[model samples]
Structures are given as structure tokens and as C-alpha cells.
Target: METISIRAPSTPSSATKARRSARTRLPAAIALLPTALVVLVVYIGCMLWTVRLSFTSSTLLPKLDWFGLTQYMRLFANDRFVTSAENIVIFGVLFISGCLIIGFLMAVFIDQNVRGEGLFRTVFLYPYSMSFVVTGVAWQWFLNPGLGLQKLVRDMGFESFTFDWLVNQRMAIYTIVIAGLWHGSGLTMAIMLAGLRGVDKDLWKAAKVDGIPTWRVYTSVVLPLLRPMVVTATVLLATGVVKLYDLVVAMTLGGPGIATEVPAKFVMDHLFERNNIGLGTAAATIMLITVVIVLAPWVYARYVRPQGRHA
Candidate 1:
């Protein structure tokens, strides 16, 4: 056979170099300028200012008077601060897990070729669409004993029914949690549904041929494949947990004597209401440290490290 040799087309190195030089001068720099400006103007700016204030005896006006670690010491000793830390841990664990489990179940049920698919999706996602201000009030009313659950149950002739968690000091925090779950699970469901839709349809067909129980296919096979989405959902939930304030404020008012008090609420109360900037910054610093400690490893594995084989 007559030999035929085809030369691979190649661009000149000068052209390649010019393109690379252009990337550095224009598109890449344009892409990065906003991010760099944002980091400086917002993220790093707040972080430095916060840390600086933490070391100061600043009050309402954020004065520049230095006062070592007195605020940190006071923060460590404050019973409310201690309790807030404990509550955050409890809330973080319960809220993240509850949202994921319930959200996953809801997503699965909704994905089952159900009736009123759009209506059901809208109903589930409406919480995400609506502001927490309204949702918190609605949940508060629903949880209130005299106005809502207890009264309704009593009216239905179960006179002894007492769902009074909303008022009880010890039980009220969980009420915030319940409302938090209700408000957040919708977002979680949406994320998981997107994940499910992206899953290979062939997996289901293979599972059927092998007679694998659907639940087993999910728990054993599918769930493992969904690590990325779960991580994304958890991070979203975790950040919300760290910034948990409005829900506590609107629903409970951090009331029943600060029983449902959260760190973010504590920060806001000090920073704006109580005029205690140093203490507020201390709390914020602690929260920031906590988030870093808990999240740094996962973030490194997910984003920083070499991508591991999914299977």
C-alpha cells in the first residue's frame, strides 16, 4: 500500500505566546479584578476590621483602644456565650441531618412520577422563594399553643393535647429548629432533585435487571454517588447555621429569657442593640474559627486536593 503521511497542523509559538499574553492582559485580569476587589473590599476587609476590634475595648462606635484578650476571656466566661456555643453545636448537627434526611425523602417521593408535579414542586420550593420574615411568623403562630396547635387539637375534642413547646424555655429552641427545618428542607430537596436528575438513567435499569431493592440501590449505590451534592447541601446548611439569627429573632425573640439565643443573635444584640462591639467581634471571631475548623478539611478535600476517582 502506498504510504500516506499527514502532518498535524500546528500554530506558531509566537501566536500561542500572543494569546497567552492577551489572556494575562485582558480576559483573565478582567475575570479576576471583581473577585480581588470583592475579597479586599468585603471579605478581607471585614475580617481584618473584626480581628482588630476583637483586641480593642470598642463599644458602639468601634473605637481603636487596645485591650489585649480581655474580651475573649470574658466571652469564654459568659454563661450565655457558653450556652450559645452549645446550642450552635446541637442546632448544627440536628438541622443539617434533619434537612438532609427529610429533604432527600421528599425529593424521592416527588420524583416518583407523581400527580401535580409542578404544584408539588412549587409548594415545596415556595418556602425557599419566600422571605424568612413571613415564614417565621407563620411558624410561630402554628407552634403557639393558645393560638395554634393546642387550641386546634383541643377544639377537635382532644382536650388534653398540649403542644406548648413554643412557650417553654427548654423546649422552645427545638421549635426554632423545627421551623428551621421546614424553611430549609425545600432548598435541600431542590438540590437533591437536581442531583437525582443528573444521575445516570442506566443505573436504574441495571438495578432492576439485578433485582436490587430500590432502597438498597439508593442507600448503597446511589447515595455514595451523591457525595458532591450532599457536601454542597451541607455547606449551605452549615453557613446558614453559623448565621442563624432571623429565625430565632422572629419566632422566639431569643425569648423565654435567652433560652433559644444563638451566636449570630448574640453578635447582633451586642453589635447593634447593646453597643458592645468588642464583645460582638469576639463572638464573631469565635464563630469564624469554628467554621474554619469544621469546614477546612472538607473544603480542602473537595476543592483543593487532586480529584479522587468517584467510584
Candidate 2:
């Protein structure tokens, strides 16, 4: 057989192609420059400033006196700070799990050819649109022994009824968890509902053909496919957990002898009210460190790993 030599068509040189691509991308980058500048000036600038303040002996205003890690040492020794850390972990785990579970159930129920889907969806999602300030007040009222659950229960002739978790020092944090679940579960449900809707109807048909149970199909099949949405929910919940402040302040005021105190509240109180900005910044630093430590591994696993295609 004679070897056939085929001449390739002429192509642009690498430098010429690179220049052309850069010309196209230059306008897009120019458009994005304003947004980049805003983020650098605002978010990143404030974060650096906050980190700087954490190392200073500031009080009532931002002062810049080198205090080393003295504030952090004080923070580590404080029992209130320790308690706040503990409460945050408990609240975070409970709030996230409660929201996901309840939200999944609600979403699944609503997804079933139910009557009045819009009304049910609205009823659940309306809570997400409302301010936490309002939610906290409603929860406080509902949990109050004299005016809410206990009073109602007692009036029903069960005079010895006692459902005063909001008053108990050990249980007040749980009340916050309950309120947080109520506030967040609605959003979770909406997310899960959207995920459920996007799932292939073919999967359900195949599952039914194979005589697989509906519940198993959900837990094993649909839920696995919804992993991205679940991850989204978890990250959102974790951020909210870190920023837990207004809810606790509104619900319990961190009262009953600092029974339900959380890290955010601890930071806010000392920063503004107690006039101990140094110590407050120290607490804030600890919170930031904790977040970095907890999230770093997950971030690395999720974003910094090489993908492996299956055989």
C-alpha cells in the first residue's frame, strides 16, 4: 500500500490565537473589575481590619495597641466563653439535623400529588421571608410558661402540667434549637422540594418495576442524587449557626444567668456593652479559628481533589 501524505490546513500561530482570546476576554475582565474592587475594598478589607483588631487592646472604639495573644489567653480562661462554644456546637448539630429531617419529610409529603401544594409551600416558606426578630418574639411567647404551652396545658385540667423548658437553665438552649428549626426548616423544605422535582421520573418507574419500596427509593436513590442540594443546605445552616445572635437575643436575651449564651452574643456583649473590645475580639478570633479548623478539611476534600472517572 502506498503511504498517503496529507498536508494539514493552515492554522493561526499560538501567539496570534492567545492574543485573539485575550482581546475577547479583556472586555469581560474590565466589566468584572468594578465588582472585584468592591469585594476587595469592602468584604476583604473589613475581614483584615477585624483580624487586626483582635490583636489590639481596643475598648469602646477601635484602638491599635499591641496586646499580643493576651486577650485570647483571657478568652480561653473564661467559663462563659467555654459555655458559649459548647452551646454553639450542640445547637449547630441539632438545628441542622432537625431542619434537614423535618424539611425532607415535608417536601416528600407535599410532592405526593397533594391538594393545595401552593398553599402548603407558601405556609412553610413564609417563615423564611420574615425577620428573625419577629420569629424570636413569637417563639418566646409560645415557650413562656405563664402565657403559652404550660398555661394552656394546665387550663385543660392537667393542672400539674409543666412544659417550661424556656425557663430551665439546661433546657433554654434547646428552646433556641426549636426556634431555629422552625425558622430554617422551611427553606430546607423548599430546597428539597426543588431537588425532588428535578429528579428523573424514570427512576421512580424503574424502582416500582423492581418492586423496591417507595421509602427505600427515596432514601437510597433520590436522596443520593440530591447530595448537592443537601451539601448546599448544610453549608447554609453552618453559616447561620456561626452567626447565631439575633435569635438568641430576641428569644431568651441570653438570660436566666447566661444559660443560653452563644459565641456571637458573647462577642457582641463584650464588644459594645461591657466595653471590653479586646476580649470580644479575642472571642471572635477563636470563633474564626474554630470555623477554619472545622471547615478546612471539608473544603479541601470538596474543592481541592482530583476527579477519578469510574470504569
Candidate 3:
């Protein structure tokens, strides 16, 4: 029997493909190096620094001395901080609810093929385009008792008209809610409108053929389909609720005596005004914790659970 020499097939093609992939990826990796460094240094570094500082008794500056949870103890005990936590909860609830309701309604209205659709969308989104500082200032002027709506109404011989929520200690936080709604509702509307446009036209036709009312169709079919958009809008609105510093600073200054105070403003006051870095970081950490607690469940439901199902 002639022994035939058997040779292994060359692996050059596989090796070449691997080499090509590396070459293709190298430039992209090089391009992303600066962003990775910035994120590691600026964001992660700052977060770690804040957490470390929260355990200290630093005053006027960041001191590396470990002081346990004294700052957190003080944070919870402080009336202003407690009030800020309460105010944020109330404001967050009202703001999110108002935005969802008003935004959904506006989106539905706009989806009706009304004339001047572009103009209406622009007008709705105009507030979001304006900076918070500008929105706050304009709203401040508009809500001012002596100079704004109340004054104008009073000048019209309705001396009994009163709209002094901006000055009332108990009601000042609600004014923040109103301004927040005005600034954020447009964004939610835009998100909802995009979701609406993506819905299959066949679904609308099916609903009509079944003699389902428009509102019923929205409530039954379209609303469920818009879950992802609602989640997106809620997250965006919730983020705005948490970092609610600039609007409150410009509009209310956390007053009528800390009635409208929020966690972000509380952190800023301790860090800068009160010269208490430990307390500031502690407040920030608490805010971070609160946000995580609120968002973790939603994140798990939306992303992690779906991934687990596939796995």
C-alpha cells in the first residue's frame, strides 16, 4: 500500500481574518482612549472622591480624615435637609405626573394632522430650548405678584385676584412644579409623538374597523405600545427632578425659607455657602442612593430581565 502524505489544511485564512479585525479595531480604540481616560478620571474619580469625603468631618475643604457617618447623622437631623428631601419627593411626584398627562395629551392632539403642526411642535418645544436660568427668570416675572400675572389681572379691575403661590411658604414648592412642567412637558410630548409615529398604521385601521373610539383605542392598544417611550420620558423627567438646582435657585432660591429647597441645592449650599464639604458630599451621596433605589427596579425590569429571558 502506498502511503499517501496527508497535510493539515493551512490556517492562514483564519489568522488573516483575526489580524484584519485587530487592525480595524485599533484606530477606533485609539480614538476612544481620551474619552475613556476622561470618564475614568473626571466622572468615576469624582464620584469616588465624593464618597470618600462623605465619611469625613471636613469643613471649609475636603479633609481626608475618616470620621465615620457623623456627617450623615447630621444630614438627617438637620431640618433644612429633611425639608429638602420632603420637597423633592413632592415636587418629583407632581412634576412627573403632570408632564406625563399633559405631554401625552399634547402628543395625541398633534397626531391628529392638525394644520400648523410644525409651528405647534416648535411652540411646545420652545421652553425646552430655553436655558433653565432663562425659563426661571421668565416664569419668575410671569408669576410675580406685584409685576406679573397677578398685577395684570388686578389692573384689569379684579382686585380680588390673587396668585401669590410663589411667595407662600406652603405653596412655593408647587410653583417650582409648575415651572418644571412648563419646561419639561414639551420634551415628553416630543418623545411620545415619536413613539406615536412609529406605531403601525394598520393598528389604527384595525381599531377603526372594529368601531373602537379613538380615545379607547389609545387607552387600550396605543398606550401599551408606548411603554418604552413612557419609560424614557419618566427617566428623563426624573433626572430633571433630581438635579433641580438652577430652576429653584433662579425662581425661588429655595425659599420662602427653604420650602422649595431640593437635594441638589442643599448639596450646593453646604459645599459653598455653609463651608461644609463633608455634609455636602453626604447629601450628594444620599441623593445618589435615592436615585439608585428608585431607578434600579425600572432598569432591571426594562433591560436586565429581558436579557435574562434570552439567556
Ranking by lDDT: 3, 2, 1
Candidate topping lDDT: 3
TM-score (all chains, Cα) for each model = 0.89, 0.91, 0.90
Clashing pairs in 2: none
Poorest 10 consecutive residues of model 3 by lDDT?
A: 1-10
Q: For model 1, what is the alpha-carbon lDDT of residue 71?
A: 99
Off by over 4 Å in 3: 1-27
Among the numbered candidates, top TM-score falls to 2
lDDT of 1 by residue, 1-311 (tens): 01111111223369877676555556645656687788787998999899889999998798998899999999999988887888888888999999999999988888787999889888887888767677789889998988998999999999898999989988888888888888899999999988888889999999999999999998998888888889899989988899898888888888788788899988998999999999999999998888899978977876557545542
List runs of model 1 lying over 4 Å from the truth. Answer: 1-27, 307-311
Q: Please provide, for model 2 over 14-85, each residue's C-alpha lDDT reduced to its tens digit, 9 standing for 90 to 100.
A: 988767766766676677778778788897787778888889999888899898988888888998888899
What's the distance in Å from true for residue 77, model 1?
1.5
Separate clash counts for every candidate: 0, 0, 0
List the global CA lDDT of all models. Answer: 0.85, 0.88, 0.91
Query: Deviation in angstroms for 17 in model 2?
Result: 1.7
lDDT (tens digit, per residue) of candidate 3 on 73-190: 9999999999999999999999999999999999999999999999999999889998888889888999999999999999999999999999999999998999999999999999
